[model samples]
Every structure is written in structure tokens, then in C-alpha cells.
Target: MSEGSVRFDSDALQQRILALRGERVMVDSDLAELYGVEARVLNQAVKRNAERFPVDFSFVLTKEEKQEVITKCDHLQRLKFSPHLPRVFTEHGAIMVASVLNSPRAVEMSVFVVRAFVRLRQVLVEHPDLAERLDELEARVARHDNTLSTLVATIRQMATAPTAPSRQIGFVVDPLEKKE
Candidate 1:
């Protein structure tokens, strides 16, 4: 790439990093692009240090979740990994990733990502109504889930129960006929 193009890409990437602030967490591919490395390389590093990440620290997106993101984020759609599913990093995972990568951009981007996560949390703290809505939604979902479980159990029992025997003439098979 030419110097001008490089600068343009750098500026665009910087703006992206900034936009990612507050509530939006970057996926592995996005971070890799900003850090100038292949996405798989970053994923391999994370895989190597699996013990450092619990589910909350890093988790793969379900197919439906990935599709929802694709629908929401325009820039995310331009990513080469549109078809490649990604794993998300929590604030702590982002910091830990920077430490392992040992690159200047990784370090710099990690600072931004961590700050963004913090900013998002701060915003949520300031919005009690949003929190309340989230709580109500969660409780509603839980109730529905419980009801669904009971319904499923009842359906299963009904299906498994033996039906009444039909009152019809039937032939009796010899014991030897049951054998192969």
C-alpha cells in the first residue's frame, strides 16, 4: 500500500476504534484488522491460553446471534469474516489478549476497548430505567421458560403413556417365530 493509502486506512481504523466505544465490543476479526494480523492468528493465541478465558471472558456467537449482528452493524458486514463466525472478548479478555500478542497496535487497541467497556458500564449505571427494563424482560423470559418446561414434561408423559389395547382378534405367534 502507498503511504497515502496506509494513512487513510489507519485513520479509518482509528475512527472505527473510537466508534466501538461505549457498549460495542469488537469481535476477533475486527481486532485483528486494527492490529494488522490475520484473524486466525489471534484466535490461535486465545486458544493456546484457553485456561485464561471462562465463558464470560470469551464465547463464540450462536448462528442467530451472528446474523443479528450482521443485520445491525454496517461496518461489521464489510469484514472478511462475514461468513466466518467470531468469538467475543470481554473487557478482561481484551486486556489479556494484548498482553499475549505483544504488539504496539494490540496494546493500544486494548486500551481503547477496555475504556469503551468501562464507558458502556458507566452509561448503563446512569440509566436506571434501562436497567429496570432489562430486569423485567429477564424475569418475563424466566417465567415463560418455566411454563414451557412444564408443558414439555406434560407432553412427554402423555406421549409415553401406553394406549388402551384394541378389542380385536389377533394371531398368537409361536416362540420359535420370534427368534431369527
Candidate 2:
């Protein structure tokens, strides 16, 4: 297929990619929509090319996880209502689907899927260091709070401390000016 035969919409594809089980994945239904095919057809292709997809490439969601996904993502309400659990395709798996389907639209849209995955990976890698830094800062701050509280108490005590008696400067000093 020619590059300009059809334009791929990366933005739309990006929205379909989701984070689950510490990896980004797209459900079969979303991929089918992107490739202009039905979900069953896509699943059939995956089944036919089973060797191409390993566990890392794709996995079926567990019942508990499926419930959590349904609870968290309103867009996946179809998954909630559907009797069968949905399978998710990771970045590599999504690209492999293109080769399996062997359609021009699938080939073109696969490029978009790959790009979306790349963008998602870049964002994940770039932003997580800050979260780690934030966690470290919070721990350090918690430790410092104990030290700070003690230091503040000591300062308050010093502020209210008693003054020592001073020696007379000279023999001519006024006795009346001094407290006995």
C-alpha cells in the first residue's frame, strides 16, 4: 500500500491505548475499530497467527482485573457488559496484528498504533523520575520534621531563658539601681 493511500490518525489511536498491569495495551475491540474490522475478525487473526503473539505480546485479563478496569474506565463499559473477557495487545502485539490481518488499512493503521505506543513509552519514562524524587523528598521531610520540632522547642526555651546577674562596673556604681 502507498503511504498516502490513507492517513493514520495517531491521536485517536493514542486514546485507545491504556495502561494495565504496568504495561500499555490496546484491547482487541479498539484495535478492530482502528483497522476497520470487527473484534471477532481481529481475534480470529490473532488465533490463526498464534505463534506471533507470546504472553508479553498479549494476555487475557483476569476476572478481578477486568472488574477493576471496568470500574475505572467508563469507555470500556462494553467489556463490563460482555460475557467474554477481553484480550489486550501490548505494543509489539499490536504491530504484529498488522502482519496477521494483511490488509492495507491494517498496515496503515498499525503505523499509527506503533507511534502511539512510542509516545506513551516516552511519556512514561520521562515523568516517572519526578515521582520517585517526590517520594524521596517526602521521606526526608518526614525525618526532618522530628528534628525541626525539637529545634523549635529549644529555641522557645532559650527565648524565655533567665538573665545572669552582672558584676558592678565600678565602686561608684549606684546601689539603688541594682536589684538585691
Candidate 3:
């Protein structure tokens, strides 16, 4: 297939990526759709090449995780009634899926998938302040005793914290000194 034949939106692909189990991953259905194949077909291919997919590369979602995903992502609501738990694929696993499918569409779309993952990584690296803030927020949330008011106060205090004034490089005369 020609490059133009398979069109994948990077933004849409990015939206499909979710932070699950502390790793950024795309659900099997999402990947299957992107690869121009059915979810069942995609899973079958992976099963055939089971050795390629290690725990880190891909993992099946637990019941709790499935429920959480369905609640969080409106698009994944279809899986809510399905008996089988959905599998999630990290960046490496996504690429592997493309290879296993061995189709032109999958190969072409994999490039876009990899780019989306890289773009997310670039975003985190470029805006470290955002990551730091998220970490701080997580820590605050972890503290069971901390109320919302206390968290707000802590943030406000940090925002209003004073910084040291810069010293003048060279000044010969004091304002109070007489000129004569």
C-alpha cells in the first residue's frame, strides 16, 4: 500500500495512549484499529508469536484495571461487557505488533505510532516543571491526613515564596552621603 493510502492522525494516536501501570500504552483495540485489523486478529497474531511479547512489552489488564479504563475512556466502553480482558501494548509492543502483522498498512502506521510515543516523551522532557508539579500533587494526594484546604495553602505559599534580591555590581556613592 502507498504511504497516502494509510492515514493515521498523530493527535488521535496520542489520545489513545494511556498511563497504565506506570507505563504509557495503547489498548489492543486501539492498536488493531490503527493497524487496519480486527482486535481478535491482532491478539491471535501476538499469541502465535508469544515469545516476542514479554511482560514488559505487553500485559493483559486485570478486572480492576479494565473497569478503570472503561470508566476513564469513553471510546473503550465497548469492552465493558466483553468477557476477555483487554491487553495493553507499550511502544515496543506496538512496533512488534506491526512486524507480526507484516502488512503494509501496519508498517506505515507503526511509524506514526512510534512518533506519537516519542512526541509524548519529548513533551515530558521539555516541560520538566509540569512533571515536577504532577509529582508534588501525587505526593500531596497520597497523604491521607492532608485536606484540600491544606494543599491549597501549601501551593499558595510556594507560589508566593520570596526570592533573594540581586546585588548591584558596582555603586560608588550611597544615597545618604553628602556630595561635597
Candidate 4:
């Protein structure tokens, strides 16, 4: 095979990442595709180094969770009908897979993968005030929300409220015989 200069697209790798069960993760198939290996090979490596991959590092999806993922991620639809449940690896577990594989290519790919995860994290960390600002905005909106609601309710009540009966403006004159 001829080797040519190729650039790693961190953005593309980031797309494969997912949030599952409240943790950011990469599915086994996606990780294998990224590492240029068969998914089975990657799974084998993980099974061999199962100790390194604790529950936090990696976990198998339950049937219901698997269905939920299939519905959420278009790329994972293939696994929807497959009997075997898929495995998911957190940022740390993905790194462990590379060490377990012990291949030159896997090691090199791991560097890029780790960088991708770190890049995603850095992007989030850079905006530490984002959550704070959102909270402040919500509080401000909520603070005035009651006042606004009351004002609207008062206007609606005035509009719908009964009005006082009006008195006759002009002097009364008998219809049958009018006298000035």
C-alpha cells in the first residue's frame, strides 16, 4: 500500500462521540472504524483487557438502551436487529483499548483519538461562564415572569369585567307630544 500525507479531521471524530447514560462515549464500531480495524478485532482486544475496562470505562448496552441508541443515532441502526448488544467506551476506556491492542497503528490512532476527546473537552471548558449566564438569564426572566403574568391577568380582567351602566346624556322628551 502506498502511504500518502493525510490530515486527521478532529471534527469528524468528534461526530462519532455520543452521550450515553449521562457519560460521553464512543461506540465500539465507531471506534474500530476510526482506528482502521474491524469491530470484532477491537472487541477481542477489549475482552482480553477486560480488567482495564471497568464498568465506568466501558459497559454493554441493555436491549432497551440499545433500541434507544438506534433510534437516536442514525449510524447505529445496523445494530438494531443484531442479537448482540453493542459496547460503549468512555474517553478513558477508548485509550485503554489502544494499549490493549498493542499495534503500531492502533497506538498512533489512539493519539489522535485522545486529542479529539481533549479538544471536545477544551471547547466545553473554554466556555465555563455559559452555564452561569444561562442560569442568570433564566432567573431574570423568571423574576419578572410573575409580574408580567399579573399585568396580563389584570388587563384581561379589565377587558372582560362588567362596565357601569351609562346615564342618558340628552334631556328626555315625550315621543307622542314634545314641548320645548
RMSD of each: 10.6, 13.1, 16.7, 9.3
Q: Which number leads on lDDT? A: 3
lDDT for each candidate structure:
0.69, 0.84, 0.92, 0.84
The pairs that clash in candidate 2 are none
Candidate 1 residue 8 Cα shift, in angstroms, is: 12
Candidate with the larger lDDT of 2 and 3: 3
Please provide TM-scores, in order, for all candidate models, with all chains considered together.
Answer: 0.56, 0.66, 0.74, 0.66
Clashes of each: 0, 0, 0, 0
- Candidate with more favorable, higher lDDT: 3 or 4: 3
Could you tell me the TM-score of candidate 2? 0.66
Model 1, residue 12: displacement in angstroms? Answer: 10
Native-to-model Cα distance after best TM-score fit, residue 22 in candidate 2, in Å: 2.0
1-180 in candidate 2: lDDT tens per residue? Answer: 454654445666677777788788988888888888899999998998899999999999989878977887777898877988899999899889988999989888888788788887787688998757867997999899999999999999999999898877867766679676
Task: Pull out the clashing pairs in model 1.
Answer: none
Best-to-worst order by TM-score is: 3, 2, 4, 1
lDDT of 4 at 48: 82
lDDT of 1 by residue, 44-101 (tens): 9999989987776677776776776666667778543666677877667778888778
Per-residue lDDT for 135 in model 3? 84
Report the C-alpha lDDT of model 3 over 51-98, residue by residue, as the tens digit: 999999999999999998999899999999999999999999999999
